[model samples]
Target: MLTAAIGTWKLVTGRADKLFAGASEERLYTELAPGKNRLIYLWGHLTAVHDRMLPLLGLGPRLHPELDAIFLTAPDKTVAELPSTADLTSAWAGVNAALLAGFDSLTPAQWLERHADVSPEDFAREPHRNRLAILLNRTNHTSFHLGQAVLAPK
Candidate 1:
């Protein structure tokens, strides 16, 4: 189970790394259309989601404030200033490293324990899912948005 969690995190982080690698500085902040979503906004939201969700899996908070700043915006807001590709890329690498470390430290019994903090009512129906499920959800969410960021217009 812990292996699965590590694999999922690696896969999602690799996708995010690829998305940022080919993008230019101009592309980082470019929106698909006027007042639409941009690469930075997508990356920022991913960071915010990670910040909020990863702690439930026993990972530490995000290390970068710029990434955390994305959480300040309401969910309805679309337009946002993007961090430079260099900065975004650096932060992503750091986050990936930290998450990998966390995953490495988890034991099989730890993975199976029901996280006390996550409410099933808050998410779907029940609150008894294991840590691995939460981690998988987060990985999927990050991958989904990373794909959107990659396809976003410059």
Candidate 2:
């Protein structure tokens, strides 16, 4: 489980780095549509997935609770008010590093422990599957959005 988690996190961080490489500050905030900004879209999706997975893994919310209140606003929010593409990329890198560290510290037995509150409808086959499952899903999810974000017009 530890090996799988580390591998998945490395892949995720690599993809995120590739996604933002050479992107200009102007490009980060550019909206493809009116009232539909790129930073907000990407950050919101990332936050939402993290919010879901963190609780399952017994981690605190990714961002502060007060910040979440702000993000709950209609248009969503940028990554911690990052005003430039470079800043945004740096922010993502920080998040990736933290996730990598957290995943690396988990033991195999901890990964397999069942969550008592998991519902039958959850996609995970059992309440106590490998914690790597969450990391894998998050990595895949981020990759999908990063692709979309790249393709989106500035």
Candidate 3:
């Protein structure tokens, strides 16, 4: 399970890394059409969520708590200011590094354990909702948003 989980993560992150490897700060704000979210928002949102996952899995704290307001939980098109692309990139990379490190510490048992907000009793009742499940859900979400990124005009 560990091997499979890490392998899946590697593939997904690899694809994401390639996609954003050449993304400039200016390009990060490009949208597929008017009123759509900027690429930076999506990227920052991804970073923020990944940061959240760390603590959810009993890993560590969020690298950018400040982003939670703008990236996580905030409704789309909500009027607000955002951080610079470079700052977000730093947070994104740092969170991913810490997440990978945390993954290395988890055994298969840990993967099956309950995640944040979901109590042990609830996790027992909903067997499918575990730490690994959270990762799977987040990974799927990232892939979905990646499609949006691909469609945005370069």
The number of the candidate with the highest TM-score is 3
What lDDT score goes with residue 16 in model 3? Answer: 73
True-structure RMSD, every candidate = 3.8, 4.6, 1.6
State which candidate has the highest lDDT: 3
Q: What residue runs in model 3 are displaced by over 4 Å at the alpha carbon?
A: 76-80
Q: For model 3, where is the 10-residue window of minimal lDDT? A: 75-84
TM-score, cand. 3: 0.91
Residue 97 Cα positional deviation in candidate 1, in Å, after optimal superposition: 0.9
Error of 2 at 9 (Å): 2.9
Q: Work out the TM-score per prediction.
A: 0.74, 0.64, 0.91
Worst lDDT run of 10 residues, candidate 1, spans 71-80
Ranking by lDDT: 3, 1, 2
User: Which lDDT tens digits does candidate 1 get at residues 40-98?
Assistant: 66776676666655566767655765555454455425335556667766766666667
Q: After superposition, how far is residue 65 of candidate 1 from its true place, in Å?
A: 5.6
lDDT of 2 by residue, 47-148 (tens): 545555555666544642332443444455434553344444455555555555666666777776654246545636766444656667667887776766
Give the higher-lDDT candidate: 2 or 3.
3
Candidate 2: pairs in clash? 25-85
Q: List the residue pairs that clash in candidate 3.
A: none
lDDT of each: 0.67, 0.57, 0.81
